[model samples]
Target: MKNIQFFFLVLNVLIITSCKGSGIPIDTETDINIEISTGSTVNIKIWNFRIDKDTTLLNFPKTLLGTYHFIKNKVNDFTAFNSKGEKLNIKTIGNKFVIYGSGDLNSITYNVNCSDKTSINLVSSGVIVDKDLIVLNNNILFGDFIGENRNYKVEIKKGTNFNNISNQQVYHKNDSIDIIRFRDYKQMINSPIIYSRISTNDTFFIGSTKFVLSVHSPNSMVKASLLSTILKPVTSAIINKIGFVFKDNYNLTFIYDEGLNEKVYQKIALEHPNSSVYHFFSTPSFINKRDSINYYQDLQQMVAHELFHVFTPINFRDNFDDCFYNDTLKMSPHLWLYEGFVEYYSLKILLDAGIIDKDYFFSKLAEKIYNYSKYVKMGYKISLAEASENIYDKSNLNIFYDRAAVLCFLMDIEVAELSQGKYSLYSVIKQIYKQNNKFNKDSLFFKMNSIAPGIDNFANKYIISDKYPDLSFYLSKAGLSYTMIHKEFGYYFPIKIIAYNSKTQTITIEFQENISPFVKNKQIEITEINNYKVSSYSFSFLYRRYYNQEIAFEIKYIEKGVLQSATIKPILVNVPKIPYYPNIFINRNMNFSQKRIYEKLFEK
Candidate 1:
């Protein structure tokens, strides 16, 4: 499954009053002094917390990795008492905390038991610890504001030995604090624990675009060097093609885990327009080391996919809800624009950079068309617009990627044809970005038709309905075509074999589910196929030649010390080939319209 990071506004709020018998003030506002110190590798200590009100409610993330300890005043003090002579009662439910503040509590504190499970992430989220490098954001450290929103001053003390810490507030909100600490302050030599940071950060620029690139892994210096060399040139190409300029700086963090032998990159975008964080999780198997060209190609594709979001659906959509917290995977109606079209441009930027050719682009589109045909035939008849909303069923969600890609491909061709090569999907996208229009079905429908006549009708037929329209006309517009024909694809053997003698040229069979009335199940000398001698080692070629089709077979075997033969003719099965066509390739020659469409598809 493809893992992409997305941010949404959490809309959970509850109104409740605390049960009060303690002499705590109700309407009076009081200062809450919260202090956090991580001077040792043992654990994090949050102390000296003073709350003024009796009933306090705050948001707490459920994904917090460690256990919490409620203490009074100091690090060693485990008693839960306040200064006002009233006991404190605290309860945690999901992402909210209801704290019963009393007069007896002088000060309160909590300790987080850190372990290996706390990995650092870019998003300003729950408690994350990388080695001894701790990141405490907003509510995770000193709980957020409660009741009426009011700005509070927080004093954070860091160990003298710590390095690379940031506590800058990006916004003026009371809960906008973000703190990150790097490296261990006190290393425990005698302790059996990981107590250091493998992550490092530096500034990188692509032309005027600034990026704070951070790599968190051992030997990440080499990866940083590789990315720094080409970051500028690649961004220049992508910015030009996407028709959007980055007005704000961003952060890119690459995390390489050797244990995870797969290539997975996720982008965690914040609510701020100036900041975007990407987490590139990869391993040796995913990063190509055979040469620099292949490595840069893979890296560039991944980077462009994330940067292009600055225009589409990100700036185009108004709001999105937290689906996970709601216990449902409700998606934005423009998810196709979010993922499918974003992916289309991700690959298109590669071609724009000259990293890929036109032929390669067509081949990719054709592959998607072929892959999407299966869902259409399976009666998964939800319109792309409907599927975009209720995509909780992951089984058919991936089809959205291909279906939208091919849809964009066809739409571009149609617009070019309708407008006499004057407008295309690129034109519509550029207009949206220029106007900063929020992407939606109605917006796109009107915007496309206004760009060129008949474009809206084309979208209605292809995008709003569950029908899979014929793409032969569009394929021909690009000077490409595919014919469906039944051919010997492959075969699967139902019988199980114990062993085969390659040197002696003998086969030993142990099990058979429904062996044909041909050869016996035992050690047999296989010598011929269709009366032809099998000494030339043409088994692979012969299998393909007889795949999906039945043919006469002859096997030479020694039964009871005598040579025997049997002829068995099986049934031939031919399957549908609609899902296998469109193998998109360049035509031998192009007409005027075909040449126009191709130029429009790749033009800047």
Candidate 2:
């Protein structure tokens, strides 16, 4: 899972950075040059400062690799050099710098600054390269400074041969490493990092954009193959659906981690228009691993969610400032449009492709509804737009996704009804992308109004206002109805089955929350439910289908080095089923117009 706390910290830093001048230009000549020969160090040269100043501050990042590591210990032997290659004087007052030299500082080199001597290390908002691979970032070579007409050139003295992110061969005319130049701090965007590996490679194009997607999953060939198969088509779908193109090579690196769910880092270059790079850290199960395929069920959805972000906040840049601190704690109110809509499409696309059935889609929707209902029941009423602005501050931040998705569900239904089955939310978004590729939130209502007359009004009520929406009305229009019931919903199993072995049809009990004192946390195996052997594939279906039934849990385990068997008759308990979302098969009957809307919803 993503470390939410760390994400918040990084968000705070970005908010501070945005408060400063973003677009100011410092006219300096000659492109910046970077030379990396070892994993533990980087050499950077600032070509020229166009303006003359008494003291220039070269800001070194205090944090390392987002918020996970600190640079205080990671960076050391920080030295500066002049145009004559002489060591210039420098002093670290605090985390920032107070430099005394004003000459043409040709270059500066520092240790890579990582405690972990792994082959691949993350540092300074980017990845570090070593003997195994070479992943580079601009932070190591360049600080946040105003430099005009400044391009960059990176030369790998040794290690692995590499290709540009665009899958184009890195042309070295006497080792050609061309760095595209841009003005302003925000425009630089952690300028694309270059990497190379010694292994043989292949190139694949995602739509018109060239991609050099490399996988370093040594443990799981299944995962590497899955990535190879899914990435291209998924990329194509996002590109075609959103109507965006890449200007330069988009580099992607997929590495295997033991227990890490896939986390993505998408870097878009303002200098190199439409150019971006992505790094995915995925946890792949080993061969013969049970539940391995089951884990991959939502993998495509995960990938789709991140890829959609490329079109929204990354490509369709957020108009508002990303401040989540006190006083100025604000963000783009269209987060619902970004996270919620992206999440909705993540599953919607899967359903459209026939990868999952309508039943599965409804189940996913129900899950989101159930989650959002918790907030509603607590009387935490906030408009979607307000929730978006204070996203990081809220304890129940996920409502940005859950509640927003529910609103989108209603909005899509509304649009279809308005167009008489001619237009849906999908079509509306495509239109918006065509008009404003990088959308401005302030102008969203204006652009959306051009597509449909009442869209702005819908936004006013559902997004901009604090009025809790009448979800039942939307459901009634969609041939469905649901009652928020308070009932006994929990069926006691005594054991929480965390990991399932698909091959053996056995579930290892991770913990036991016992209703009686008969059970405790131990190494136990649950092989059957209601006297029937259950496979990992059928676990979810059976559990939900027989949720209310009094079932027997067949168990087997080792106790004091002896195999044992027991049947656990779990005590049933009642749980709150507040703010229930209507399922796909509505209990309420549908009228002719509602029926037409329902049919159109699943139309391919």
Query: For every candidate structure, what is the RMSD over all alpha carbons to the true structure, in angstroms?
Result: 14.0, 9.3
Mind sharing the TM-score for model 1? 0.60
The ten-residue window of minimal lDDT in model 1 covers 185-194
What TM-score should be assigned to candidate 2? 0.66
Model 1 agreement with the true structure over 458-554: per-residue lDDT tens digits: 8787778877777787778877775543454534333334444444544444323334663445345554444543321222322222355444556
lDDT of 2 by residue, 1-604 (tens): 1211111000001111121245554433433334443333444334433324545675644432111123342445667667787877887754445556754565555544422312223423444544434444444434544332333333333322444433333445333333233333333344444443433234578677776566544334433345657666666666667666777766555543332221222111121233333333333322222234444555556666666766666656445431111233356788777778878877787777666678788877877777777777888778888877666464535776698888888888888888787778878777877666666678887777777667778889989987667877887787875544444465545445567664465666644555332446755665654444544333443233234556554455545556566765545655642223445456447788898888888656
Q: For this target, which candidate reaches the highest TM-score against the unseen true structure?
A: 2
**Per-model CA lDDT versus the true structure:** 0.49, 0.53
TM-score of each: 0.60, 0.66
Candidate 2 residue-wise lDDT at 198 = 30
